[model samples]
Target: MKKLTIGVVGAGIYGNYHIHTYCCDKNVERVVFCDLNEERRIATADKYQITGYKTVKEMIAQEQLDAISIATPDPYHFEPAKDAMEAGIKYLFIEKPLATSVKECEELIALAEKHGVKISVDFHKRWDPAYNAIRDEIKKDEDTFIRGYMALDDIIDVPRKWFTWTDKSSPAWFLGVHCYDLIRYITGSEVEKVYAVGNKEVLKKEGYQTYDNIQAILTMKDGSNWTVENNWILPVTFPKSNDGQLVVVTEKKYFKNESYRGVKSFTDKKESIPNYIFMNFTQDSASGFGLEPMQEFVADILSERPFRTSIYDGLQATRIAQAVHDSCESGKVVYL
Candidate 1:
């Protein structure tokens, strides 16, 4: 079998993982990195011992990339993804919430269909064994109440120091999208209506021009109701950067997962929850829930198999997120 050549856009936290996986995967022939930040691009490339480019256009022009992963910030996904699909890349893996707007999501889906390219959204929650087990149990019941709260937060340092684009995003876009996709994946239901409210005091007082938290009540098409809570205001002293739980209650059974506390540790100064489930590098070759979906995308392209998470799944998740943002702004329930 011929090895596939891969290129990655964005060299941030998540994008680095994609680079690592592609570099370590035996099926890949060559891997390249691209980022607008020259420092990050060169550093990541040097660390991984791969060629680096300043932009996707430059990378594509120079390399015979068969597959590309877009790990850019949420709002910047559309352009890179569009370029890759139009460039005839066989496989495109995008980090979730697909795109920043519903229209962009539609355009991506249309573009993928037009280009005959396979698109997979990196909603890694679907790959979680615990979440998959819950999904199986929920599938047994026709109806169930799903209440999920995923508060994957960072210290004030994230918005205040890490990146300055917090105003262009919100907790809804950053964190809520994951919960939305996970609930949809678990219950296999589309979000029909959304009522949401947001608080801006925390991040605002800290000088960030975005909401600190958002609470949304979602009504599923199957007549099931879900309450989702999202907040990025967790203190720096929190045990983990991400902390939350998910509960799916059916007539016969109840499943609850404390994902953050899956593994715990204590130190002299602070406590921490090491997330081995998402991306476990300590293993042979970065095998975990987060890496599985992406690897599956590559394998599917190589084997000509159907994708587990389609582009439509990404679009639906974005649609729900857009509605949640709309409801938060209008102070009324938004119907899908």
Candidate 2:
């Protein structure tokens, strides 16, 4: 097998996963990681036992990297990615909420186009096995309402810098973007507009800079409505009612990672899973929600295949995210 050289541009909590999986990957020749935080960079480098760099420029100039993962803070995505494209990396996979603002996000879309680099956003939900089953289920049956949710209470305890901001970004970007992207992908359409309301009062009193919880009514192209609720205030250990309840909908039919009928071998459980709906699926497969998808994406690039989350996909998600922000900002229904 011809191994590829991969580098990481961020060493934050998220970047750790990319580095770990890429380093152990037999197909990866060498791993290089970059981050400004010296301790994080050094610690991750030491643990992974791979090269580390102070800046993206340093890494690009030093390593013959075939691909790079842009896992930096939301505000810093553009510069590192711009550098990687200029250096002619064959592929760039960015963790999403693509950029802090729409303008920067558009520039990224344009840059990747001009440079002809294969790019994908890490909308991890797309790769979920459960989601695949759910999609198949939706096609096989009918549902009046599909309710899916992600919560604030289920994540880590971080500083206000980590969330609660209407200025740089928020938990919506951190959390809601995934739900938005998933809803859009499963629905096979783009989000038409977002009408959302949020409560930052509790966060404000806590001296937090952003909303504590937000719920939005999203209109999709199919004329179907989807609801999204996200928060940073929910306890990380919150008990989930189903599939950890990250995904839930009406009893008629809905797809969730927790419940789906296999398409290959007919199963008795299709009728067994609660709130069960007839869904077509086969072989429970690893959704590649992690390093696995990254590897498959590399294969797709090698085979010249289409990537699921193209630059346009990221930009579209960005547009929806921005609209959600608009709805929150202006206290009015935001038009697409």
Candidate 3:
């Protein structure tokens, strides 16, 4: 039995999740992190009882980390991941989209291959029970996937307040990547082409230079068509931080899922729907499909098992997203 020393980059909201997850992991002996925000670095280190550095290079030089988990902003994953691999760290767990550009994603993949690094991308929707059920049902028989509709959206505050990089990201990069990856995971196919249209008015009026919503039509290699719609401009009054639904149609089957899974709460100030299945952090443990990808990253490294989602998966998702953006800008179909 062995233990690992893990390093996490970007100590923001999702970064803390990575930190806490590794901290509670039995196979991990220590967890250290780096964040540019002095306040966040101090707060996250204090909360997790772990050392925090101000830069990925500093953390890498100081800690004998067996792996590095990257939780940087949506558009900034490349550098930290590159730093880890270039420094010879053998394992990585990266939050979704991998990188905002296909070239960056491809570079990261090449670096991982060159350095013998194993990388896992956190497209957590693949772990969703509902999505898995859909996958399973489709696998039971040769049902041709005809079409799919997936919409993932966040409340207005998510872009306006959650992070400071909203201008550098869009609904596609932030949310649609999950849907893109999930579509591939479920269908075991690749996106052949994409045609997308998006509106920037809402965020533009607010001074954010990004799309408020993007709707993409994807033609898969398996001949299935998927419509992925993503937005973060839901009225702040929406019960949850986000809302989503998935509907898949096959020749003989239909599958549907809602983010709100029969749970609700009422307070004098607000109404809420608790997505218990996404993330739950207890006193000593964290559980949920959302966290499973992180947990599995640790387990697979210790056991030498393959990651559920590989760097290639990350690359493919980025390719689709990049194409989606290209299509949006050009107002024409983009072939992948």
Best by lDDT: 3
Q: State the weakest 10-residue window (summed lDDT) of model 2.
A: 278-287
- lDDT by residue (1-336, candidate 2, tens digit) is 678888898888778777766766666778898998899888988887788999999998998888998888777788988999887886998988788678888898788889988888888767766777777777666554445554323333543434333446576787778788888777676777789988887567866677777788887766767778776665433332122234546447544443223323325533223222321212222223555557666677667788888877777778888888889988898878
What Cα-based lDDT does every candidate model obtain? 0.83, 0.71, 0.93
| Alpha-carbon lDDT of model 2 | 0.71
Residue 109 displacement in candidate 3 (angstroms): 1.5
Q: What is the TM-score of each candidate against the true structure?
A: 0.95, 0.82, 0.99
Pairs that collide in candidate 1 are none
- Candidate 1 versus the native: TM-score? 0.95
Sorted on TM-score, best first, the list reads: 3, 1, 2
Better of 2 and 3 by lDDT: 3
Candidate 3 residue spans exceeding 4 A from truth: none
Q: Model 3 over residues 1-336: C-alpha lDDT tens digits?
A: 999999999999899888888888888899999999999999998998889999999999998989999999998999999999999999999999899998999899889889999999999998999899889999999789999999999999999999899988899999999999999999999999999999989888988989999999999999999999999999998899999999999999998888988889998989999988888897579888889999998899989999999999999999999999999999999999
Off by over 4 Å in 2: 141-167, 236-288
